[model samples]
Target: MEQASRTVRGQGMSSIKEVVSSWSDVARLLRGGDSGALVPVVIPRDNRGLRWTTLVWFGLWALISGFMLLRGAWGPIAMVVAILSFILAALWWWRSSIVEIEEGTVGVLTKFGAISGPGLAPGRHYLWHPWARVAYVVDVTTEIPYAAPVLSSPTHENVPLKSIEFFLRFRIVDAIRFVQTIGAGNFDLVLSNSVQDAIRQRSRQVRTERAYDLRGSDVKDMQELLNRQLTRYGVQIMGCNIPDVQLPDQYREHLATRERVAKELVAYEKEWELTRKRRIDTLLMEIERSKKIRDAKIVEVKASLNKARKDVAQMLEERETEAQAIRYEIETQARTNLVAAQGEAKAQEQLATAYRDNRAVLGYELARRRLDVGANLAENAPRPVIVHTDAGSADNSALSTLLMAQLLPQIQAGAASRSRPALRQQPQPTGDEVAQAAGSAAQRAVQAVRGRQK
Candidate 1:
């Protein structure tokens, strides 16, 4: 019953409403949902200048008001007309100047070739134009999808890579160049084709191995190169992304086999290395054993030779000792005889020298006696003493007299020395009383000298 009621309600609507509902239903089907409230209107096939025509009508009224106000209308009327004219001009200019640039940005301008902006920040903007017409408004900022089609090479044994779609988020850097080169009417086609060309060129230049390598650095390099190449066509490849890489079923099998073969080869090489090492070890052991045998034989021969050498050395040493003893005896006898000869010769030489130096000997004896006298005086005398000992004093009176005279001079010198005050040896006494005592002693000495003379 609910289904029937809904059916009646749907049928009760006017033809127009039903038509709109049907359109909504179609939209819901496309969106994969149920339509609730939506009206559909027929879109004009020739959507050329419908909006422009409407703007023109409104602008024409304002232009007429502006002319009337300038011809001396009332003050309020003139102001209103002027305001209306300006608004209409602004509106027409905005509509004309507006353009859909790359990335959904709009551009505005005036009729005198002056760019009216605030350039479109995405959606819509209104402005005025005097003489200029908006040339081309294009969506220069749009993601251009690029695909590099690379079929697998059958001849190559290396891994095969499949076709890949590369997404490039791009914005038109140069609007003028984009419209001129990319043809405003067929921009999408041109953009897609250009992107495709660049991708193919770059992909072809790089080897298949590098692409499948999945190296981050390699992908970045390719993206940058693609951007730079496309920049000349006013297409900025903002980002190039590799979302998927499709591989053939057969390629998967081949890859698996290659991996298996690689693992097997590694194992086989490892075993071969082990075998080689064993062989090398065995050879080394044999060489070592051979060296040991050779060394043993050499050691035995060396021992025998060493024993024989010891015997020979002992015999040689005994012979050498006997020879050394005989030589020592001969040398000792010869030295003893030579010493005896030298002693005799020395005795003769001494006799001849004694005879020849008799006068010098006598003079030396006299000097020695003088020296003894001086020595005796030095030993016995507490103070200085003179010694005038003469060598010929026993028989010569004049010599004796001369010696006595010398002694007398010495005695006088000693007395004079004794009379002098020994200031260095004594401490000075203090006060006049000590000085008086010193004077009295001096007077007594003088008196004694006088008494002796008498």
Candidate 2:
């Protein structure tokens, strides 16, 4: 019996050695020829123990199987129960390694105690449970808002300003950094604090009225400032908004009162301007009327002056005509007088010249005048007849008278010749005249006789 047992043990040992050699060859084949060859590589697993509950259940199953074997009841079934208990323990440990990352979210991984290569993307992912953990499962797509408290104004140093409500929208950009610094569970609280800090700092630079008016720009500035702070924690700020603002009641009432007073002052100024314009208009109208009156007076004076000048001109013309007529009359009278005086002087000269040239004619004219006077005396004298024949008788007056008559003519001729110095001197007649006178008497008697006889 001992030899038979030894032979069987030798055969079992040889079979066990053959299985070990085959396993070594399979390990060498998996290792490949070189380090750079394309071959499946196994990562080193973390050292982790099974869960206490699994171990306890496995121990309980082993104990049960051992007790069953000691009692010699269904030995193969007890072994199968023990093997199933080990499998149940393995599956229970593997449950933690099975990770399901939801859509739009990523799972950050950590091996042992340090961060691993990259984050796990959405879908089913396996990890070494209890050693490699899903550090953080962050939603990189969804935005989360952080609200801040009311802030004060910088303009009014002591005055409390409006209550400003603001919100910051953010999303996780780096899941690894987010897990390392601000974990997903604490992101809201940390972002809220950062937003409050940004609001407090930015509010100090803006006035209350300006903050209310430019709320959009103010919120945008807060978002940018908050992002600078959150970037360290792997968070990004997407947007910001200031929804409501509330001011103090007292300040609003003060502004309203000031506006009302300004409106009243403007109305008063406008009324004063209107009154001044009316006064200026009245003065302008009076000035225009005075100018018109002055122009009319000037025109009237000019007309009067022109009429006076015309009258003076006419009077001067009439005076000149009368003066010319008087001058002409005086000149005509002077010329006529001159002509009459010249004619009279010329006639006297002619008469004096004729008398000087004919002195005998002048004597003849004087003699003729004396003869005419003697003849007239004789004609008027009375005739007396007386006879005296005695020669020496004193009564011979008749003969003497005849002789005187004959000599009278000769005496007048001699007197006329002596009176004119231009006439020739002549002697008086004596005996011849007496004899001529006696002959002439005798002849007269004979003729008287002859006439009687006849």
Candidate 3:
């Protein structure tokens, strides 16, 4: 039994050694690989887990120290425990001096009631509470707005502008100067005063009507001027705005009345213009219609005139044809008359030539004329006159001669009568010659009959 107890004790001692070695490894890791040295660190107040750990450690230490005191253990171990508790309490109090500056914020540090350095940046920083202090934690990134109502004369002509609400946005650029001059608590008041002063100074140069027109430019000018005033105190003006403006009641009413009258006049002019344009359009349409009618009439008249001219031309052509026919007929008739006259003249000339060339034929023609005259006389007178010829006288020369002698005196007397200028002075035949010729012709006829009877 003694040997078995010895082996079990040895096994328990080995397990205890293993446990102690694991704890030493953990402690070394926490001390940054040096078991005998402590790693310096800064603790952030905003770390909730570290804050809780510190609270729990303080509670545990107080409880342990109270328990030791209650047991009346006033020995070296009690003193050691008290000393450790005091040190932990001191560390916990020191942690309270640690300041955590978030991003975009600046921590203004002051030592012995004066600015110590430039400033503290973002992250955890140690500042002793009594000796060294964080005077201000300024939010340099956030823009602060300041607004106020102002009253001023816009035109410097006694016309006051009221209830003009102006706004200014600004931020702290130099935290040290901000804390030294204006401080965080009075930042809004200082910015508001600067904005009001700038607006008042700029407003006096513009009229109320021009103010509205130059609102944007006015705001920008106000921002620049405000920055000039606030820059010395570390306040930078970001922007300025005029959000609202109001005119006096009387002025507003007057403007409304004028606008209403102007609109009525404009409407009247538009109606008059429309009526005039309508009349002009109607006149143009009438003119177009008249022009079309005139053009049609002109075309009709032109056609009639053309037809009349054509008819006149045709009638003239027909008249010319008739005249030509008449002229041709007259020419033909003239030529026929000329030919007939030429033939008649030629026949008369031939007859005169034959009469002049042959005397025997003339004598024979004269004898025939005398015989016809004597026959007519015998038929009219109381006695008959005849001439006889012998049968043996085959050439009737003697009879011919007797007839010529008997007709010559009568022919001569006729010729003389035609030649005389006056018919009353013409020579006449004697009655004796006429009786003798009759007697001779009768005796010859008696003898010829007697001879024939024997």
Candidate 4:
């Protein structure tokens, strides 16, 4: 009822600016507005942009006046003095107004009804009193912690899920923007929502497999991407990291089986390839060795053939020389035979000539035979035929001597016989005996003479 009476009294005040001239008029306006009922009436009154010195001056003046009245002094005079003291003290305090800013602290102060500065320093400063007031104080050195949310395919193909989480570190860079956009009280909410949004955006572009296969480096990239996007809100993102990734049971089993089969197939193929290459290389080496042996044998045979040819040539030369020597010997033997034949013929002719030259040898041989016979006869005969021949008669004397010799021997014998008878018993030769001896001797003498002459 009291608030209704005040409203009625303030109705005559007309404009809002004029109605709020005193504290009671302001209270009445506040009471008339239903929206301002719950709000204490002191808030608008206290937040009237009043300086600290103004409040102090008002209190000092009130106290001095009360004290003067209690002492029972000149009340009116003391009241005037008290009001002047209060005004002077207010002036002094206004002249001594100070603004303080600390490190990592921002202070915005108003002075003389105009905003002075949002000073970023850590010390005391002065500003004009009465209209000067501290508008805002900011703690510039605060750390922000945040996180990223990610969803991945589950290991089981049947149950793909969204259960992944990460963390981030950030700071407030622009104090003014941070304060204007979202108050410090809502800072955590803003950062969390922004990071989660960025993660979802980035995740949509990636495949489910990629998210499931995320590693430490991938987690780091997520942090960097989030930082860039969240920087516009005066938020300095330090790091965004993923600590864990979750998958469905079925998917994990399938992936493991696939990897196992691939590894086994690769190993088997590699072993087969190695074995085949070794076999081929061994065959090639054997063929090369065989070729080398064949070439060496061929060279050996050629050398042997050359040696054989040389031996045959030597034998042929020896045979040719032997044939020449045999020819020479045969020729020499023929010459020797011819010479021997000629000598034999010459010897035969000489013997023939010697035989032909011996014609008188036969007469000499007959004479020798006769001489031997004569010697034999002489030895056997007595000496009875002695005939002498006259030297002058020569040819005719020989025959005559022969006849006379015969006759004379006969006559001599006859004459001796006749003389002997007379002498007494002398034996005398007979005529017949004498004649026979003379005739034999004469014939021997005649034959000898004729043989000697012939």
Give candidate 3's error at residue 17 in angstroms.
Answer: 65
Error of 2 at 366 (Å): 99
lDDT of 1: 0.51
lDDT of 3 by residue, 1-454 (tens): 5346325423211100001122113323222322222111111122212353465476566667666676675544655665676676568657756766656767677777688899899888875454676555555776655556665435445566755667666677887787677654355446545655776776777676555543545467677777788899887878778776665667656656866888898888899988999999999999999999999999999999999999998899889889998998898777666655554454445444443433454456567667756754654344333446688877677778787669866765675567444534644334454445445544554445444433
Worst 10 residues of 3 by lDDT: 12-21
Order of quality (lDDT): 3, 2, 4, 1
On residues 112-196, what C-alpha lDDT tens digit does candidate 2 reach at each position?
A: 7788877888788776556676555555676644455454433335456556666556777887787677564355446555665
> Model 4 over residues 101-206: C-alpha lDDT tens digits?
5455554454553446554365776654456665544444544343345454342232454555656666656655655565543554455556556555555555
Q: Which residue pairs collide, candidate 3?
A: none
Best TM-score among the predictions, by candidate number: 3
**How far in Å is the alpha carbon of 384 misplaced in model 4?**
99
The 10-residue segment with the lowest total lDDT in model 1: 37-46
Computed on alpha carbons, the lDDT of every model, listed in order, comes to 0.51, 0.59, 0.59, 0.54
Flag regions of model 2 displaced more than 4 Å. Answer: 1-49, 52-73, 94-96, 156-158, 184-190, 208-211, 256-454
* lDDT (Cα, 0-100) at 226 in candidate 3: 77
Clashes of each: 14, 0, 0, 9
Which run of 10 residues does model 4 get worst, by summed lDDT?
12-21
Q: List all candidate RMSDs to the true structure.
A: 24.0, 35.2, 31.0, 32.2
Q: Candidates' TM-scores?
A: 0.35, 0.41, 0.43, 0.35
